[model samples]
Target: MTRTGSPAGVLSIKPFRRLWIALSLSSFGDWLSILALTALAGSLTKGSAENYAIGGVLVAKLLPALIFGPLAGAVADRFDRRITMVVADIMRFALFLSIPLVGRLDWLYIATFLIEVVTLFWIPAKEATVPNLVPKDQLERANQISLTSTYGSAPVAAATFSVLALISKVLFSQPQQQANLALYINAVTFLVSAATIFSLREIPKQRGKVSVPSILKQIVAGWKFVGSTPLVRGLTIGILGAFAAGGAVIGIAKVYVKQLGGGDAAYGVVFGMVFVGMAAGMFLAPRILQEFSRRRLFGLGIIGAGVALALIGIIPNLVIVALLTALCGAGAGIAWVIGYTLIGLEVEDSVRGRTWAFLQSLVRVVLLLVVASVPFIAGVVGNHRLHLPGKNIYRFDGPNAVLLIAAVVAVIVGLVAYRHMDDRRGIPLIRDFVAALRGEHYTLEESTREHGVFIALEGGEGAGKTTQARLLSIWLRDQGFDVVMTREPGSTKMGMRLRALLLDKESSGLSSRAETLLYAADRAQHVAEVIQPALRRGAIVVTDRYIDSSLAYQGSGRELKVGEIAEVNRWATNGLVPDLTIILDVPSDIGLTRFASPADRIESEPREFHERVRRGFRALADAEPHRYLVIDGTQSQPDITRKIHDRVRAILPDPVPPSAEDETSTMPAIRD
Candidate 1:
């Protein structure tokens, strides 16, 4: 059966579920702590100094990343992830508990700095450990769940803080004491997280081999990798840009709310709305934009955020500002998930921790700069009142100016990043975006194929692919159209040699990776030498096997990641997908029985292998029914061929000559 890694399916893994729960609790605590900390900073001073004080607190929280972020990834790599997380959580618990008890601004700064230092190490370890907790197929879904839990807890945290604020009002008169209840709760959550992480045995233990030179080398290598890889570079820029936009909103939110004649409760609601939007974005992205290219999606998300932020600055109403903030959060949320998922899939385990640390470090640095400076800048610009003729007054202050400027910068960042990493360059953005909204995968019509058709027949061992291919080619040729019939693994001169080595039963001990690569190489040559050339000349290019065959036979049958295989094939074929892929579906046993000759190297595989291949085809077809035609191989040869022909005719290029159309109507039925 085809595996659908839904949210429920991913959460069903016991260890992952535990980790997710722990993360949720930890995230709730972290969000609650942020509110308490910022509120405490605001309470520490009055008037213009409040912005400065809040900026100082944020700077303290993020400054450690600049100093220690590079080494944190190496720490995750060189130590046990579980132990690292547990220890960090314990440290944070103590630090948070001391904050309210100390009741001093200096102590708050010191504790905040220390908390961030511990967190820098904890985050990399946590992010790197996640991939090991679930199956590869479920990795993306797992990330969606993890991120949802992390940010989804924000609203809960906000609600809890609001309740505590009310309780503190009745119980205590001091401003510092008002935040004490929330701080104590935050401290308790870290302890809970520590205990939960201690129980998960699934997080793989890393080698504790530590050396100064090795550490330095890894840090350098990590930087080099980020700098050298275009995809990584673009993703880093995109993610940082998204966070900068978010951070600007966060930094000014408290004071901006007050400026709109709102109090702490309104600020809490605004904060909660951002997370609500983030949660909604994470939950809905996969379903709504499932067919959209992730690269383009990431950029679009950032642009949407920038647009919303611009509006947020211009709109004066508190309720509308909150709604706009949610929209901004939604965009940032989409970009965050896609960017992280791409990194997880692209980065290897050995360097994964370091890569995450690098990204996290930059994110913190961006947040630090944005939060530390934007508020101060807003204070510098101060508030201004514009009077209208009808006795209406509009407030256009430093916050509004700052937000508009940040929005422009964010949009530019998104455009640059999009241009750097876009895979579908010639495709129109608006057309593709609309198609994605409608749940369609749109590929720009290739200019090379003036009137050509590309078709592939895919199936198991004896699914009559060869017979169908021959009959289809003859029928098309009889209609006065040029047809090039081909098959993979023996389609070209290089493929002929590859076919012998691949199919010979004596070729034992051939590794799965080697076999996959060999098939890719053959397909690469087949497309370049025969397929593309035929299609460019406006001929009907029919092939017995194509990219899908490798996806089924090697990807699913060998238990390799289908996505990895698809990526390889996509590169090999230069992103040339068939206009139509016909899968001759049949039961493995029945298909095997039809093969008269002794089984080849592939066919000789156990019955279970073929079953996987069959399921893989069905899954592929199910994913894109618009581009596939699945036929029962058990049907009469004539019946199958007629069905295939009808489907092919619908997609064929128009402007058929009058004689060709006349002959097509009178065409004889295809035979096997």
Candidate 2:
């Protein structure tokens, strides 16, 4: 959720790094095998039989997932994940090595199917293991890195295959021999992956007895959970729709390219470009749309893909088609990464393996159906050309017509899925998108237990922040809420030292950047030790000050960039924005005069500087009016307290109704 930091932080975890490397190697090997097996299949047959042979190999590779996916997922959930992955990899290595040694078309199909079956088990285990290795908040960034490795390795694999092909041809002078060498190398990659996974001790093993009935029960439960949970159901449908669109594009691409008067080379370039766009979207969309809700972004990506696919059918220019294809790929990339991250964040660890397996199985089935059907559908549609006015020719083909239909379906899927899965409800999608484009920071309401309400009181010197915070804490406690009264820069034990350094007059000469960093250090510790833990325990936390103080005093008053300071604070707090911030508005001169004694370092600043600080608070409130409650600090203490109570009451859940006996027993008077 903290978009300010680089994704490199996820890689800093040694265990995740090891898994990432294994994933990359395995992915590279997978792509390489695709090329090698296809070529080998062609070589094993003659004339038109070669085409059938290649198609058979492809089908054999994909069909196992459809047949064995559920069982694979069950196996992953029932056993030690590290052992599951290692065993899967070892099986893959052995099967891959056997392919060339057997050297028969039938044997090739058997080996390919076996390898894919093992891969199905490895994938779910890997997906489930990732969330355990990284912190919950860092799941998005970790998913980003995993996805990049998953898809980004394709180009490298293609290049490696080409190099291997050249070397084999020059050394052995046999095309079949070259294909065999590539397979041998691909086999080695799986061995390396197995060795790597074996070294990872962090992947927890399933405890207690494992049985067929229990595994089946878990699988059934996983399916039921997916079907019953609206968010998960919506995510599943959206992911399938995205895959359907992609599968259609891939299945019909060869014919579509020819329809546009292009050859194999054009098809290759277009294919490569789509993945290039996908990599760009995965890596850059987070930074570009940093402020947008992840749920909205997922929906938008699906919509974007649908729109691009629709446009590709309408536009006749091949270059334009290429661009549209790239855009579609980019949208798919964003949706894919976000969807995976959401699963990790939302799903429980106990059922995570089975849930991921169900998703994986369904995805493979949908992809296979779309990939198998699209080509046939396009073939049936055929081609129709009409000569129009102004020497323009209009061509309607099977690919074009099928694409238009797929686009419509995809759009409908996106709209429905968006409505169901949007976590930030009531915020219009277009407004959120525009706000994100402008880089405005906002809070995303996660669908977690509504455990606590965080209210931050901000004001200049002598503006009664401490008094208001204390009053709110007491009122909340009286209403039967567990209240934690705290303050920034001095809340935790470590923060006490930081607070002294920040407030002491001797530290007045501290550099602006250093002062800013000191505040950030205190805030980081405060959030970790005080804020997050209390909130997790369902305690209402009322703090005297938070990030806004830095924004006001250091950012605006010191003339430093507010945006940079905001990013620093965002990183420090790991994107934990307060639910509500009450800004007690008071004139700088009057507020300063109310302080009867010597001022602290921040308070001792000039009146103009304090005025700038006041304006800073006002600007923030204006930007996010819903989150901020601006009150006149000059009002009576009772009046200010009543106003805050009203606003907070509207946000909090209604209190439980007391029983008649309890009501009769407790008729205590309200305190001033």
Candidate 3:
């Protein structure tokens, strides 16, 4: 799906529609049951059954996943998952609609089991669909936007359904009984889900072995594939751990109302809050994935989930529980996203079928186990009818304790797995920091520097850096070099806001490190957009201040570590270094004299700080003899321009005039 071209062209793909429709419809129905299902079960049976049946039916439904998962996975792998998804939805439609008709408990049990059979295949098919729909490198963003659409729509639809159910309850004799509307509505969603699946055009299907040579062999093969890949195996194990604990938390959430506080309705809030967390996680995931390794993010998500789960047992307040549940949801959402992202990245298009199938099977089996463990754990937790310990009987009331146990285990395993993920660990750490500089190295080297140069005018507060940048731009253009000069911490949208905060005299108590970071973030955008393109087009790329400003001013003047600023700049530019640095050596008093207005925030720094900044610049210049050219900042504007022009000529012969035959060399490739 790496359809690399103009980004707008990629949105035209049809598979996106199918992905959107399926998630929206499925989640909407899932939400209705989220609050209603417990009520439905409670009405159908006595108190014991109400308690056990919810857990029981879930267990029963999930059981087939343990037995039939491999076979279903094989089917999804062998045949067209599109057809499988379509058929599965149709089956769910029939079963959900028919579930309302099943008069006996046995029939209901059978229906529950049957629906999960459909789910076993459906989950994997849906999971595998995204990479097919979007290009490879864009997968993270595509996945992000896709998940956002799903999560964003689900809540709106759920709220609509909740209101509908509430209104129907007032009109109906038995509001609990009328919850069947949700079942029928869910059934319709399945129908809609199926229609969306069917609407997509044919994709190249992956083939799987249908010959029943050995079921054990295929199962073994699936396991082998999972085990062979470091990424898949580690993440799958982590995912299983996360879900197992998460399911426990969900299963016991209703018990919190009975023992702690709130009821089945409270359970709804917990889940709804969790979903809200999903929306938030989807929004922030790109940053996490970009700045941090996938494994680290995955670990953090799990660790957060586990910690929240543990906290629920320790601090058992409804409000706190709600907050933690939301946290748990957010963590889970992040974990889920990372899982999807990793799967898409690790698995090839052809083997994606088997990979997702295997993944889905594992999830189904784990869910079933989570469901099965509930009653047994509940039985163990309750005050014994047969003299079992109260700890054993309290499983329903204290599920988080068990969840906490799971969380602790997950954290330990994740920490170990974290050590093995080597692809990203160190590179991005430095890359982000380097990117914070005004004009990074990549912006310089990649630019065909024959006709253009990126002269980043940089100095302390009231240093006349901006004026010099403009002056240099004018001089360079007159000399026949096309010049582009821009300022740091204000070039891009967020950067401008950051620039205001950094330079504002009124914004007191700003941390030096915070100031340093803001400068880095702004440089990231300028390099990506302004500097790189200009240089690439053979134009002179000049900036007001490059990374050196941060190193000299923030790093040395403000006493922040140069290393830390370097790290931030590195990440921002992907480790790009500037081709040359021309340090404007000016006494702090002379620099201040250049500004007619009162000193802005940073300009008001102590004279000692300004001295350190000037010294820091000179120190950097000394370290890199060839790259840095120091010019007297105290010189008149004309003399200053002449000196800067000489430095430009020394780097590369000054550009020919526009009227000259070589004018084409300075033509701007960049557009506003």
Candidate 4:
């Protein structure tokens, strides 16, 4: 079944639905356990000892990921994922149930560590299972839903803990008893998660043996692959950087709030707002910035977070700081979703588990280091009140300095990752981002309509688009179909005049925008008078030099905004985009060398201009790969023709046979 690229699509699969529910319950229970374990730790200690006990429990939760992550991932890959998850959940259920029954601080810490170790194994298995359960296009939506469920359940768990505390006070009359009840309830959630997973028999078993040497080899191979692949390496670094930024914020949030003249209540509000922003960014950013590349978006998200964090350090107002915190969280959310989606899409299944494990472990370690050191670093930095001229005072504190440093580090890391991972190299990032915001990026679906297939040929000067179009037209006619052979800028009576004006040497001084409009006007006339009419009649309309040529020459070559040029052309053509655009890619020097006669006004431009035009054509082709056929113009003419013909044949409808009467009456003779 074809799945829609929406949240509903993933939910439509029964096994995925069950798995998703299990994940939600498990995550909710995990958070509840954290609160319960901390409360238990406090009960077992007094004075300053309570703080250490609570910190130790939290640190214990993170430490196991560093130690057991690779081994857990190897086990996940070598055994049945369904059994792994179920067994892990069962162990967690028993261990969590014992945490309260045993009632010792050491036992509580040990149980927490064991729970995290079991969770490490469960996580990689679950992460590896998700992609197999959904369609490729729907992976992002699935991840979005999973992340929403994972993080979204935190507030509910917190609220549930609060309510359970109230009920325990009223019924049991002891704080320890209340904490123990919450623990018991959390253990039961694991049991429920286990039962849910047990019902999902669709989870696949491991393909290979689970020997020690094999596990070690797989782990090494996974690390080598991550180090070798540029995209994965960039993703890993960007993800870790994002986590580090978030960790710094979390680690210093309390002190930062205090510096802003706020207390625990204010800190809670800011913390909640961060998650709110995260939810907004994940749920809304993709929809708003639909046309932007995910690679660019991910990098931009990190940069945005860094910028927001820097702004927070400079601003002393608690309200502004809270808003900035939310903004930072939103950016982190976008990066998180895009990064995980890329991993699932780009990484192969063989090493997917290990890759996920490595990512998880690295994130945990970075977070651990950041959390462990930020407080110490803040203490060493100390606080100072700076006096400036004109009665101005700036109070600089440890939290502010830490945040400033984090912001710089995050921005630098983001830039490095962007340089490595950006797919659309050479295009300005700021310009693309602005264009995306202005709604100028065009989607293929928006440009195409249900009609006869329209094919366009595009290239630099003298790349033989006219020849290719003619050959394609004749081939279509020979196959017993009606074919409309045409060219833009001259196909219509009005277009001829505009084309002449555009090409004449006298128009050499025309402004770039004027030249762009002239080309768009010619396209408008050509499409209205010829292309759309033929397409509506179900004829194959093969055109030479369509919208792309204008985009290349007037936009890229002339250095005008491609998005603005595209918008004008889109309006002029009334959204009649070609079904297929075959870009005959040729080097500028080679293409220019083919024009032996005196150059036309546009062709007489510098070699640099022509090179830009050539690159522009290639860039447009790269952007919409499925709609384009980019062939080397230096290839043999017959080979090029054959390639075009094969592609056209795949999409062409069955040919209609000629009528008997029409066949009999075809006796017209040529009069010379």
- Top TM-score hit: 1
Sliding window of 10 residues with minimal summed lDDT for model 4:
207-216
> On a 0 to 100 scale, what is the lDDT of residue 257 in model 1?
81
RMSD of 2: 20.0
- What is the Cα-based TM-score of model 2? 0.54
Q: What does the lDDT read for residue 165 in candidate 3?
A: 58
* Candidate 1 global CA lDDT score: 0.81
Q: What tens-digit string does per-residue lDDT give for candidate 2 at 535-566?
A: 88778889999999998888767766565787
Residue-level lDDT tens digits of model 1 in 1-672: 112223446888899999998999889988888888988877777887777777778788768767776578789888889999999999999999999888888899999999999998898888888888888878878987887787678899988887887887788887668778888989999999999999998888973333222333444556865753445677878888888877887787777787787656677778888888877776697578776677777787888889998998898899999899888888888887778766764444457788876666567667878988887688778878999899999989887878887898789888877875575555688898799889877985655455578999999989999999999999888878889999988988899999999999999889999999999999999988998888888888999999999988887678676667777887788778998999999888899998778989999999878877887777566545557888888889998898888888887664355456467886543322
Candidates 2 and 3, the one with greater TM-score: 2
Q: How would the candidate models be sorted by TM-score, starting from the highest?
A: 1, 4, 2, 3
Error of 4 at 542 (Å): 7.7
Q: How close to the true structure is residue 117 of candidate 1, measured as C-alpha lDDT?
A: 90
Query: Can you write out model 4's per-residue Cα lDDT over 337-393, one digit (the tens) per residue?
Result: 778766764455556787876666567668888867776667677778999998999
- By lDDT, the better pick of 3 and 4 is 4
TM-scores, in order shown? 0.65, 0.54, 0.53, 0.57
lDDT of each: 0.81, 0.77, 0.65, 0.77
> How many clashes show up per model?
0, 0, 39, 0
lDDT of 2 at 15: 95
